[model samples]
Target: MEQHSPSIRAQAVALMRQGVPNRVVAERLNIPRGTIGWWRSEDRKACGETYEQPTDCPRCTTRDFDESAYAYLLGLYLGDGHIISKRKQHHLSISCNAPQIGLVAAAEDAMRKVMPLPSVSQRHRSGCTEVKSYTRHWTCLFPQHAPGKKHERRIALEPWQQEIVDTHPWEFIRGLIHSDGCRITNWTTRMVAGERKRYEYPRYFFTNKSDDIRKLFTDTLDKVGVGWTTLARGSDPFNISVARKASVALMDTHVGPKH
Candidate 1:
C-alpha cells in the first residue's frame, strides 16, 4: 500500500476546517475516508474546535457582531446583493461595477465584519467584480430575501432589523446608495443681463424597478431627515431625486460617490 504525503494530509485538514465534509474531502484529496475522520478528531483535540457542521445558527452563536456593519450589509443586500439556496447550502453574492472598486472593497470589509469565519471569494465578470460567501445564515440576517425579482415582491424589514438600521441609518443609507444610486453634477445655462451663465450643482439619484424597495429607500432617507423627489408618475423605473443643496450636502457627508 502507498502512503500519502504530508502536504496532501495538510490540504485535507484545511478543507475539513472550511466545513467540507470528511467524505467530500477524502474524495477531493484522494485520501482514505477512514483516515480523514481520524485526522479531524486529532485536529480537534489539538485545537479545541471541531470541523463539523454547526448545530446552531452562526448569527446566534456570534456574540460580538457589529450591528452597524450588519445593517449596512442588509442595505447592500436589499439594493444589489442576492442569495442562492441549493439543498443545504446558501450563497450570498454582491456585485460592484468595475469603476466602483472602493464600494467592492467596502462590501468585502462588511462581510468580514459580519461573518468572519467563512471564506469570501471574488471573481470578475463582464466589467463587474462579484464578492460571494457560502453561509447558511444569510437568509436569517436578511429575511427580505425571496424568490423572483425584488421589485415584484413586497419587501419589509423586521422590527429588530429596523432597530439596527435606525441606530446606524447613515451606514445603511451609504450601503444602499453606493449599490444602486449615484451622485453627479448637474449643469444648466441661463441668459441673465444679455450674457449666458453656466451653473453646476450636485444631485443624488436612486433608481430601482421595485416599488417596495424604492419605498424602503425613501423611507429610510425620510427617517434620516433627508428629503427627495420623484421624477414622474408611472415611471418605468422609479426614480428618487435628492437635489436640494442641504440634502445633497447631508448625503455627501454620509454617502459620497464610490471611488
Candidate 2:
C-alpha cells in the first residue's frame, strides 16, 4: 500500500495498458524500470489480468486529428448542420444542396478526420445530400447547439474555439461561406464619360438569419483583412457582401466557387 503520485502513476498505467514496454515507459517518463515493472506486476495480480504488448495498438496506428479541420467542420455545422441526440447516441448531420456535392464531400472528409470512426455516409433527401455520423463527441465539440434554432437563440464561440478560428481564419471562412454563403459574378453597367460600360465582377455574399452568426463571419473576415459591407436593414436574410476587389480576390483564393 505504497502511495504514489496519482498523475505519474496514471500516466504509467495508461502507457502500460496500451501495451507499451515497461522499459520504454519508464524511460519516457524518466522513472526507474524496476518501478514500472513493479506497478505492472501489482496491476496484474490485483486485477487477475494479463498485460502484454498489443500487436495492433490503436493509439500507435491512428492518424492524428487536425484541430484546424475540426474548427472548419464546426463552422460548417454551425451554419448548415444539425445534431439529433437520442439517449446515449448523437448524430451530426450537415445538409448541402445536391449541386454543392463538393461541400458535402468535404464535410464527410472533415467528419472522418475529426472522429476516430470508420466513415461518414451520405443520404439524398429531396434536393440535398445529408452527410452524417453518430458520435458521442458531437455535443462536446459543438456546445453552441441549443434547444431552438441557431438564429432564434444566441450563438457565441468559446475562447478556445476563437483561438482555433483565429489561427485558421481561412478554413473557418471557407466552411462558413461554403455552408451559407456563395460567390457569383455580379454585373453592373456604368457611364464612363459619354460611354456606357458594362462589366462583370466576382463577389462573395454570405446570408444568414442569425445576427450573431453574421457578426462572427464578418469579424473573422476582418481579422483576415477581408472587407465586407452589410446590406440595408429589414432584409429577409441578413446579408453581408464582400464586393471590394481585394476582398473578393482574397475570398476567391481561399474559398473559390463551391462545385
Candidate 3:
C-alpha cells in the first residue's frame, strides 16, 4: 500500500463522504483507486457503519424496469428456478439443459435486463447448466420463493407480477415452454388408396407437478385464445397438452420448441 500524507487522506475521505465516487476522488487527488477505496472502508469502520451493497432493484428502488423480460423470467422461475436467500448465500438460480445453449443465454439475458447491478454466472453440472444471479433482492422480485418445493406449496403471483404477465403473455408462455415444456412430433402410417401414407402430429406439452402452476399456464393459454387439455399419466395429471391444430399453430408461432 502506498502511503499518503494525512492531509491528502483527509481530503479524499471528505470527498468520498460527500458522495463523490472512488474513481473521481482518485483522479482529483492523484491517488490510486484501491487506496481511495481502502480509505473509504477504514473511515466507515471507524464510524461503526455497516456497509450494504447498493442495488437497483425495481421493487426496492420503485423504478421502472424491463417488465417484458421480468414476465419471461417469472415464468422461468416458476417452471425451473429457485432462490437461496440465506444469511450469507443469496442468489437466484435457473436450471437449463446443457445442450440448449440458446436457452442458457436467454436466461442470463433476462436476469441482466431485470437487474443489471448484481453479478450473473453459470455453473455446469452433470448434463445441465445452472444460471445464477447473485442478489438478495431476488426475494423482493419473486415473493413466491419459499422454503419447500413449489409443488408442495401454493404458488401465486403478486398483483404487479400478474400485471406484467398479462401485458406480455406471449413472453411468459415462451419462458415457461423454454424451461419445462417441449414440442414433439408424433407420426403414424396409414393406408390410403392402396398406397402407404405417413402423417405427423405436432403438439406442445408443459409438465409441472403443481396444480396451481398448471392452472396458471392453462389460464394464460385461454386468455391468448389457445386451447389446451390436461393429460393424466396413469393417475397423476401433471401435463398440459396443446394438441388442437389451431392451438398448436398458435404455440408454434409464439413459444415454438426449446432452443
lDDT value, residue 153 of candidate 2: 94
Question: In lDDT terms, which candidate is top?
Answer: 3
Off by over 4 Å in 1: 5-51, 54-58
Candidate 3 TM-score over all chains jointly: 0.87
The estimated TM-scores of all candidates read 0.81, 0.73, 0.87
Worst 10 residues of 2 by lDDT: 52-61
Top model by TM-score, which number? 3
State model 3's lDDT. Answer: 0.93
Q: What C-alpha lDDT values do all the predictions have?
A: 0.85, 0.84, 0.93
Poorly placed runs, candidate 2 (over 4 Å)? 1-64, 192-195, 233-237
Instruction: Please give, for residues 1-259, the per-residue lDDT of candidate 2 as tens digits.
Output: 4456989988998899898988899899988888999888987888898654332212334544677887789779878999988875678999898887788889998887777453478999899999988854577678886798999999999886888899899999999888998899989999999899998999888988998999999999999999998885664659999999998889988889888
lDDT per residue, candidate 1, 1-259, as tens digits?
Answer: 5688889889988998898989899899877899999888988999987455652344577466788988788878888899999887788999889777888898999988888866788989998999898877778887877889898888888998888888999988888888888899999999999999999999998888878888888988999889899896564658889999999999999999878
Between 1 and 2, whose lDDT is larger? Answer: 1
Which residue runs does candidate 3 get wrong by more than 4 Å?
1-39
